[model samples]
Target: MTEHDALIFLVALATLLGMARLLGEVARAFGMPLVVGELIAGVLLGPTVLGRALPDVFQWLFRQSTPQKMLGAYTTVGVVLLLVVAGLEVDLGIVRRRGRSAAFTSLLGMILPLAGGILLGFMLPDSDMKNPNQRLLFALFIGVALSISALPVIAKTLLDLGLFKTDLGLLVMSAAMIDDSVGWVAFSMLVGPMQGNSVEFHKLLTMGGLSLVFVAGTLTAGRRGIDRLLTRFADELHGGRVLSLVILLALIGAAITQALGIHAVLGGFVVGVAIGDSPSLREQTRATIHEFVTNVFAPVFFASLGLKVDFIHAFDFRLCALVFAVASVAKVLGCSVGARAGGLGWRESIAVGFGLNARGAMEIILALLALEAGLLKEQLFVALVVMALCTSLLGGPAMKRLLYRAQEEDVVALLRRGGFVARLNATTSRGAIEELVQILEPRLGHLAAHARNQVLEREQMAPTGLGDEVAVPHAAIEGLEEPMLALGLSSDGIDFDAPDGKPATIVFLLLLAPRRLDEEVRVLASIARSVIDPRAREQLMEARETEQVLKVLAESAQRIAEERRARGPALADI
Candidate 1:
């Protein structure tokens, strides 16, 4: 490339990265997904906005074929790294433990969406019949698109929303992972015909044999060999050997699948799942992969996807309407029905559907692949991109609303039915002593307040601050009408004798019945753990009024209660 061209490319890369970071921070500030910002950055840099505004500058920066190809290559690497990291971060044990539910949810979600997308494809007036098999391919592509639930996006969303450690979050994440796996398998089957390969009995048998061989070889021989190799290198290797080894394996695995006529992503995913399932390897691999992918490469992938999206084409109102309608219906019906059938309540079922509907990076990648393969028209690709963005944008608010509408008393009842709450009151702040006293003092006599203050003062002698800007103050009180909790917030923070020596701004006062020490302590511990969440802590600190503080506290408590209930009568029976 010429010097001027090289300079332009560097400038473009720098501009894109800066835009991505700025947009990401803005999105985070507004409680939105960071992906949203990356996407917007793409649009701003693409043909629609900035390109239109400054045609000469846009041409100079993104003009040359070489630069474009380089960007695409960088983006592809980002995608591979993302998938590998995603695979590494997954909790395979949870999937195994919730095998039945995960399987059921994933199957129903995939099948229904696949069916819906196929049916929708048939309804489209533009669909051609000259190549009957092409139609099937189209249908299958739609199904794959509709059926996919962004497992990584969902996990990040749940974690950001403070739902990751909750039952609903866990179930949603497990189901999404299973759904993605099943969807990939279905895609493989569909792609077979597109490749001019028949799905004969022999083919099926051969595929099955290969799968079995791969599993056995990877699990037994492959894992052992790698384990021994790593053990040997643990002391000798320091900086980049571990990551270098993983990348080598990932590429080799991808190559094997490509040679086998299946997509490389499938092989990469399988390798990830296998490595993730191994406790000894999972953390090390995850750390290495995340460090490389998220910090170094993810922006390029996101930007590349952005570059392909033609906002001008997406702006066609008629196409946008159709895309939105089909995508929304497929996700809601597919996941909601699946979740309900899996025995989730109406709200939870709806949540599962919305949560699964979020299609960000994955859908965009799939659409691009189809476009490049000549299986999809540019217009159709634009439609899909629009659909993916709409779903992703809608998911957060839908989930928040569903969670907000959940009745506290109903949650308490569920807890009781599951055996978790023995004579529990809705007012109990999960055994928060100070919160309980604050809630009860207005209705009680002065003597009660004095006694409560005495207990609190004595307990305060040995600070409850565990550091990290968190403090748990508790007191044992007798003859309480009901267990109560008082949650307080101070953004400026407060001084506490914490191990970290940081000032504790967020405090949870646990008020436990004198005799229920064990149960109350457990409850206090749960609350304390939840409060440590960065987002949750931020929300607590930002709460400007009592109502906001109470809202945050109530949501936290409800999440804890629901999680305990979903543990299947063990914690509930306590």
Candidate 2:
């Protein structure tokens, strides 16, 4: 490459990164998903806006072949990393907890949308398909596109609504994970054996067989091998080496899948799932990887969406509106019906529908693949992108409202109820428990001693530590007529045998009446969800005063309530 070309590539990369980050922050400030900003960043820089307004400069910066290649390389790497992180977010254990509900919801969600999309494809004009003669391929592409759900978007929305660790949240995430896994396999078969206008069935079967073997191998033997590798590195190097190993695993996985005729992202995702399932994986390590990927790779990848096609030239308003309506209605009704069939309540089913309806980044990625494969015309691709964005924006607000209606005050409010300890003078888990019990002594008298004994007994059975420097030590007592809690903050974390290997910095001492077992479980779940966000957890860890901690929790609760009220009832039609 010429020196001139290299210089232009560097400048373009810097500009794209800057614009994507700035816009992403703007999207988050407005309570939208980060992808919205990233996509818009691409649009602004693409032919639709910047290129149109400043033709010469835009042409010089992006129209050059070298600059395009550089941008493509960045996005390719970024996409692999993004997929790996998305896979890591999937928790099969959570899916198992919901059991039939997640399975049924995932199945119905895929079927109805697949049918609707295929029907819509047939309904479109020959002009709407990039390869008019290949109607089956186009129809299949549309079906796969509509059948998938975006796990990252759904998970973030659930977290924002303070339901990330709840039964409903787990069900939604697990269903989305299933949809993604199935959708990718279907996509592999659809696009892997394309030879001009024809698809070779024998080649498709070969690719399908390879993909199944890859998935099975990754989940079983591959998972065990990666776990051992990570453990050995983590035990010795103890710091950045583990991060390097994780990235290396993603690269290896991407290479294997790409060579096997499946997309490279699938490989990254499968490896990420294995990494996430590892028993020795640390929360701090996970957090570091997440922050880096979310800040750097994700923004660049999403922004790259705009660089391929001009939204203005590719968009057909009527087609865009129609496609959006079909995708949203089909998913909502199908998922809602499935959830109800699985024995969920009316409101819960509707909430699940909204959660799953979020197409977000995954749909955009699939649409891009179909466009590249010549299965979809430019207008149709733009329509799918539009549909994805609209559905993504809709899901979060809708689910928030549904959750708000069902929201009630709980033991979490004890942060505000005045049993807050600004500092804990304990270095061990047992000592922390004793300190918390003493805080309750003034009110409970001799009952405090009994509560301490009960909590210690429970701890012996299993640690209450939920990782992320948080623990909930609770026990039911005979004399208590009401539930009580003491919130303790420790600047110096205590040893609590947390699953993630993090020390306990924030502890909740909970006491419930003997018969209120159900309430005790619910309260514990609520606390877990509320503190899942790293930002919130950090705030709790750093607060100088007890009231400051209360303020943080109160503000989050208030934000959710206000947003829910503003949106009113979360209906399918909306």
Candidate 3:
């Protein structure tokens, strides 16, 4: 490339990054997914709008084949890296823990969606250029589209909704991850014949064997070798070497998968998952990759998708409507049935169904694959894309409402059971013990006005600063009018000498009457469990006034209580 071309490339790269950041911030402010904004930016810059208006300027800005190809190549690499990071974040062990539920939910979700999509396709009239066989391929393509769920997108949504650490979220995430992996394998099998190549059983077996060997070898030998190598590199090199090593590994992994029958992304993701197990490696690698790909190359990938989306040619209202209906119904029916069969209540079933319905990056990738394989026409692909966007964008809010409603019902039921008392969260900068004293002082302070009753003694003890910039302080208070609880958060983190040596920004103070102390302690433990969540912590910190804090705390308390209740009452003594 010429110097001028290099300069132009840099300029375009900077512009893309700036646009992505700007749009992402805007999206966050509006409570929308950052991906949506990035996509919109792409559309604005693409041939559809700005480029068509000022062709010359656009040409000057983006350059020609070489620059475009360079950008595309970079974006492809970014996607592989992104997928690897995503895979690394997933906890595969959750699948084992919830084996029965995961298996049931995943299979039900996939099979129902696949069946619905196929049925819808069969009902559609023939296109001008498409024959019956082509239509069958289209049906299968739609089936694949519906059957697939974007695990990464759903994970992000769960985190955003403060559900990532919840039992429901944990089960859903594990099942979805397993489901995606299986769906990809199924997709490969389905598309194999369409590649115009004879089914070579030997080759397939060889590939499978090789993949197994590769994964096992990487885990056993490669990881240790890489760890040693990274340590050495860290000691030897100054700055860019760390980043270079990560990129090299990512590229090598991608190359290996490309050489194998499966795509490059599979290898990249496996490598990421392996590396993620190492704390030092995962943290450094995540930081480096996030700095490079998200800040620089990711926008281009989203833009490329928008640029290639030919809405004019692919805008069939009827087809789009049909795809939407099928996809939505398939997800709702599949997940709801599975959850109900698992013995979940109606509300919980609906929440699970809606949560599983979200589709983003994975859906787009599947549609692209189908289009490349000639299984789906432009119009069909566009319709599917619209369905994905709708499902992902709308699912979060809908699920939140369902869950909150269920929580309220559970709270009312628990209150009626006669074992529970009033729930309250106190907001104060004072320490947990001091806060508890203050709470008791209003009623019981008179008892120790001049000569201390020593009724409400306070202890500091150990702090519970659970690493991600959060802390929990517990105290055993003595004299109290009645058993009570107070929850408080500080904008500035307070020093509590936690195990991790981090200061506590949030505190949960529990006040209990000696008679009901045991039960109250259990409730306090439950509240602590709920507050430890990173998203919930963030939300609590963001809350401005006492009322807002109470509202958020109440919602959290209700959700936790409902989830516990959903597990059903324990058996009585025989």
Best by TM-score: 2
Residue-pair clash count for candidate 2: 0
User: If scored against the real structure, what TM-score would every candidate get?
Assistant: 0.68, 0.81, 0.69
**TM-score, prediction 3:** 0.69
What lDDT tens digits, residue by residue, belong to model 3 across residues 1-574?
A: 7787677677766666677678866876676766777777766776666677887866776757666667767777877877666656555456666577667778898899989987877787778213446665566666877887877678777656555544466667876876676665555444554454234556556656766766677656877777677666655643476667666787788788677666676677667656654434533345555556655666666666656655666678888888888888888889878866765666767777888898777787677666666566778777777888889887787766666532222221221221211222323223333544454455555532221222212222112343455443333234544444444455556554343445566654444444332233244345554665566667777776655565665677667668768865331100
Which pairs of residues collide in model 3? 426-487, 455-479
- Measured over all alpha carbons after superposition, the RMSD of each candidate to the real structure, in angstroms, is 11.7, 6.1, 11.2
Sorted on TM-score, best first, the list reads: 2, 3, 1
lDDT on C-alpha atoms for all candidate structures: 0.62, 0.79, 0.62
Residue-level lDDT tens digits of model 1 in 1-574: 7776667677878878788878877876665666677778888888777677897877777767877666666676666667676666556566765566566667777787778888876666554322345765677677777788777778666644545544466568788887776665555545445554223546645655565566457656776676676666766644477688777777776677667766666666666666665534523345556666765677656665566656775456665677678777777877788777776667778877888888776787677776666666666777777777778777767776676543232212212221111111322222333444545465445635754674456343334665567665555566644344545554555554453556566655445455432234345435654564566677767766555555665577666667766765331121
Leading candidate by lDDT? 2
TM-score of 2: 0.81
List, in order, the clash count of every candidate structure.
Answer: 16, 0, 2
Q: Model 1: how far is 260 from its true place, Å?
A: 2.7
Q: Candidate 1: misplaced stretches above 4 Å?
A: 1-9, 127-133, 188-241, 281-288, 406-574
Q: Give Cα distance to truth, residue 500, candidate 3, Å.
A: 13
